[model samples]
Target: MALTDDVTSCLIDNNKLFKDIIYTAQYTATSANHLGYNDSSKHNSSSNSSNSSNSKPLPPCFDLKDAYRTQAFATTTVPHDIENPSVKRIQRRLVDKFLLTMRSFISSLLSLPILALLVSVAIYKTTVLHLQSSGDQRHHSMDEKKEALDELLSQDETYYIRRWGYACDTHQVLTPDGYILKMHRIYKKGPPEPSQGAKDTKKKPPVLLGHGLFQCSGAFVLNEEKSLAFMLVDAGYDVWVGNNRSIAGFGHISLSHKDHEYWNWGLKELGVYDFCSMVDHVKVHSQVDKVAYIGHSQGNAQAFVALSLCPEIADSLSCFIALAPAVYAGELVKNFPLSLLIGLNDWFYTLLFGNGCFLPIMSVAQQIIGPKIFCFMAYSMFSYLFNWWDHHWLRRRKAKYFQFTPRPVSVRLISDWISGWGRQGVLLYVQSPPPPPPPQQQQDGYRATSMTTTTVSSMPLPLSAVGSKRKLPLVVFYGTADYLVDGQKFVEKVQTCNPFPMLDLVHVERLEGYEHMDTIWGHDNHITTYPIILDQLSKVSYP
Candidate 1:
């Protein structure tokens, strides 16, 4: 891209400038030394003549008095000693001045590249942004595909969510801490079915989908009809997508957007309050005692955090499905430049996104790559993170990527992982008693006495109770290539840190060719991934 080329040119310019500076410095140092030598020799001749009693007179042809027709030129003057420490100090001062001048010049020149990098990034972003806003595409030979894309250029989240046959509802969920989250639910539309026999009509359990980093709930419906949201509805489950504080919509009921409190939340707050509150709301609305949970990447990590805090979540929840669950990464996608890129990327993110939300699609980034070329930009930009070198796979999946990702995500949640500043791994699962469940409803239409409101796990840090032998049923769908989903490392950590046995890891043995994002939105997800998820859910006994 123009941005990349400009950066390359700036780097070359910096190198050339450095070489020139070195040459100039060498020349300046040499010239100063020659001048110092001539001055010192003159001082030495004058000083020796004044100090010696037997003075050596000059030859008649070279006499200064004969040439000037005057008396002795140096009478009564204190002749300077070139060998004195004072004279040497003066010479060193001259050389130091020359060196300082050269260093300052080189420093000023080197600084230009920093400005150039910023300018290039700005100009490239500006030019692309202008084209996207122009919307004057008559020069494209009147292609229908171009027109279709032009129409889709202005669609928002609600528009995309309703594209499939599923109905979308945005519910305002108020957390305990006053954060009002807009949770989107997708359910099949028709007259209400039987609440009758299991053999005659087996009603599906309520399922909630959690979006990964920098993405909204639209990730589920992005694959058109084949997305996980639609597939779950077709398979007879009530589907709801929970949007964390990272998205653009959620905020506090009392705290205004202008208030600093609106932006003062993190991933820990999300796990502690947002998810549990949403789960409570869903159970109340759907009349289901237990729910099924599915999450991708950061979604999976936060959910595990919630589970670790409350181990009874396994009983309150039927089963958990983690799609390329982002436990941790030893490195970002096993390679050299890829490793370097991850470190630099984290640095850039911290430099760019200091606080608040990161809106890549809606902000200046949209101008640089534009709405139409979103998929191309995403595929090319993130191709380094995946094992996506095969020409065929890249060609097949390039067009669909934009629909699923590059949405607004919380800076606090995403920066820790994306910026690569720290190892943003999941919390440890500890051996402790399961947190008590919510109070049961009495048969006389009265609520039973509730236990203590707060539930906190007291397990010691760094795997202190591995001998306690407690476990929760989990199903993981991961790929061989995703660095985030290290199969061996994940199993070992769970076994060593928690009471769970590593050998019992429920892996998707059937589906092979899947990567991190492919678990939820792959084109053939209904055929390959749905069966695995459904098989795990089917094992749960529905009331």
Candidate 2:
């Protein structure tokens, strides 16, 4: 009874203490039996009496352990009946709770994807509606555009013909080789001024303007008002827009040679022959010992080659202003895709587009996706996003006017540019192959040739021909952010030329915030940058 009382007290205080009380009671009972205590029946009888009394609903002081032990033993004894029911109820509750948790977890995982799909659908609908609205607005804008175009055309007629008295005269100049090179002379009547100086002295200083690749004089002399030609003419410069050979304005040939393939030549031939011939003709027609040269892109390349190869023209040039000049193609092509394409196929390009035969494949490609007005607009928009202000101006300026007669240039010329001829001159100056060891004997040394012909192979002319000793006044202006030309490498190569002792004049001017095309086509070209160039020209002494 005492053991039962102690166990009941331990269970009420803490359930874990009941186990210790049970163990201690069992050990004491075993020790009393082993010591031969004869009162075993009395202890057993007392314990049974206490259990029975607790089971019969006795007072609070009655043993609760005996009742609890009796219930636990009954629960274990009825395994087949009550035990199965209780276990099944607990298992069902557990399964229901697990399923609820799983469903909540699955829904949480799918929320993001479902939300994203809904948002995507909403955006698509909004875009479609916006596009439909824009189309309607465009239709309305078209009528407005037409009215504006008519007004602009009327203004163009008045400004170009009636007010300014500008005229475009097409002429032919015969080269020594008997090729009749076409020329376009856009001149305006002299501005009203006093006759204080010589009669010819009052004539405006002629500014010969050249255009870029895949363009003509019309590119620069765009419209009556915004055209560079018109601006220069208004500013009292005799504006002569030169269309390089094979361009729209310069495509005309002599009747005898109209069908000849020789008339269609690349810049390699253009630089050597066409430009040289044009310079000669301009000098003779103008009757001026020297003239100012302003060239854009390919025009600059042609000028460099002509001046360098034919030093005689150097005396005839008052000053050279190259806009986005492509003189050093090796350095100019650092970021351009054309450089990689050319490097891949330099050895095989001649077979691809040689002997006046254009590549049919490239021709087809160009025809399919040629540089159209819309394409130019899109490119200009992207340029604008990148802060290429000049390109943006070029796009907006050109879009305001329509080209009357656009001409097709030979694919062979483009091929030559991609292949090597355009790159060869610059590469020779930049990439020097190891020199042949000084001849084993004096007699074995190679001798320099004195030929002055310009129809050499794509390889650069010998260093002797370049005249390593002559230090010509070389001024290179490049844009730091230009994608076409590597301004740093160009400066380095020019320094390596070592045009020393005779005033190795290497003036490198970096135009900030300019891209490859902005040098010529930028909006503020005439106002912002041209005066700086003119100042440089004033310093040059013409022969």
Candidate 3:
């Protein structure tokens, strides 16, 4: 923002300077014309005609002096004309000056980004040197210091995971729609030995962890041992971390990231294709009929759409754990600037961010600035935008938290999310038909009416419509203080509407003072958040 202000100020000052220069040139020409310099050219022309051999061209100052004398002595004066050679020369000089100024302005404007990059590089180098010096002085081994530096500087999730003494394996799964997403599996660092825990590892149920918007799978593993991924691993669950399309790196089977078609997807596609494909892959890999699923914010939103619309994939989840689920506009978003921005048309949004990935340059900036500076900028931006204080964040590992996130997502995806804020009720991928009326309502010609209702005809009927069918367990952990999305309001709406009977056994826990990000990064979350998740995961009956 400071950089933007500096550039704006520069432009404004240059505009004022250009206006002043134009005014001075105009004033000088007008003064010359008032002194009768326009007639001097004709006066000189006639003289030159009469004494062609004797006459030489008058100096430029001579014309002004001759004009002043004629203006005082003669009875009439000639009007200013653009065709005057003297005036033309002056105009050409003015044009040349203006062009020179513009060239300088353009060069400076172009160099601002380059200057910012150079500064970022300088800071990065200085930080690297400082870390190396600190590492040498510290009691830790060289490998440990290297690991710490790698976690601070690397963009890969596996580096973060392995840095904390956890094993990480990267798996690429192909979605039906041609998007190849990356997933990370976290486990004990060493190979499985003939121990009791190692023997039981194969028997453990697999758990899939999905990150929030603009975040990759690395978000859950940033806090080292305190991170949700490591906690899950410690809790004897096989943890699989999932990424949405275009995150980390754009991996499409046929389309390039530069192509608009590669990014021509929104939340619906994420849920329908990315989430479903990952679940299927996890099931096949784990050799289980069902896998426990956990999602954060927009991750939960995708799960709601996927589990509600696709019965087969819905059945594949042993339990759906939603942390600070973002399915509706919160109080903060429903007001002021956010509401106004969200109300704009899709074309307007596309114009703002272009048709491709959203803010890909931020990733480049992050790499240049290094994690500490990037983390500070990110925190400041989010704090201002979301009115968050981040009091609960694990401050020691805050830089690492930002090292892996703010990944590239489609502009269409962000636009869709923004559009949803303008409406009331659950955010839907496609407009679903109104749910079937209750049996009593059907018999008496009365129907259920609620703003949050959603029903898919292609999927199996709800449990209310078809009594006592197998239902997907949806466990919700919401923060009372989260203003980005009203998780409490959504939970209440679901309970009141009872629209999704497929999610009949919905469990909701409201954390008293937690914020949106606190669900994942809160201090002592392993004790507060993970235990609840672990308790819920324990209830799932694995096949």
Count backbone clashes in candidate 1. Answer: 3
TM-score of every candidate: 0.58, 0.53, 0.66
Candidate 2 lDDT, 1-543, residue by residue in tens = 123343344444554443343333333334433545331121122122221221111111012123222222221111111111111112247787676456444543543354345445544554454466553423223323432243232212223433346665554543222233456666665556555667535665566777766556666654335456676666556556665655532222222212223334444445545565566556655667666777776777777655544445565566666666574553434433344444544224333333232322322333344345333433333232222333224333444322322234554455445433334534111123233344353234324322211122121112333446443344455666675545545454443343112223224556766677666655556654566665555555545
The digit string of per-residue lDDT tens for model 1 on 213-260 reads 766676676555567887788878888888776364545434443322
What lDDT score is found at residue 99 in candidate 3? Answer: 67
Error of 2 at 222 (Å): 2.2
Q: RMSD (Cα, Å) of candidate 1? A: 29.1
Cα displacement (angstroms), candidate 3, residue 100, comes to: 31
Top-down lDDT ranking: 3, 1, 2
Best by TM-score: 3
Q: 208-253 in candidate 3: lDDT tens per residue?
A: 9999988889889877767899989887788999999888567654
Check candidate 1 and list the clashing pairs.
129-367, 246-410, 346-419
Error of 3 at 111 (Å): 18
Clashes (backbone N, CA, C under 3 Å), per candidate, total: 3, 0, 0
What candidate 1 gets wrong by more than 4 Å, as runs, is 1-157, 192-202, 248-250, 256-261, 333-352, 359-364, 367-369, 385-400, 418-471, 495-511
Worst 10 residues of 3 by lDDT: 73-82
Error of 1 at 383 (Å): 2.5
Candidate 1 achieves a global lDDT of 0.50
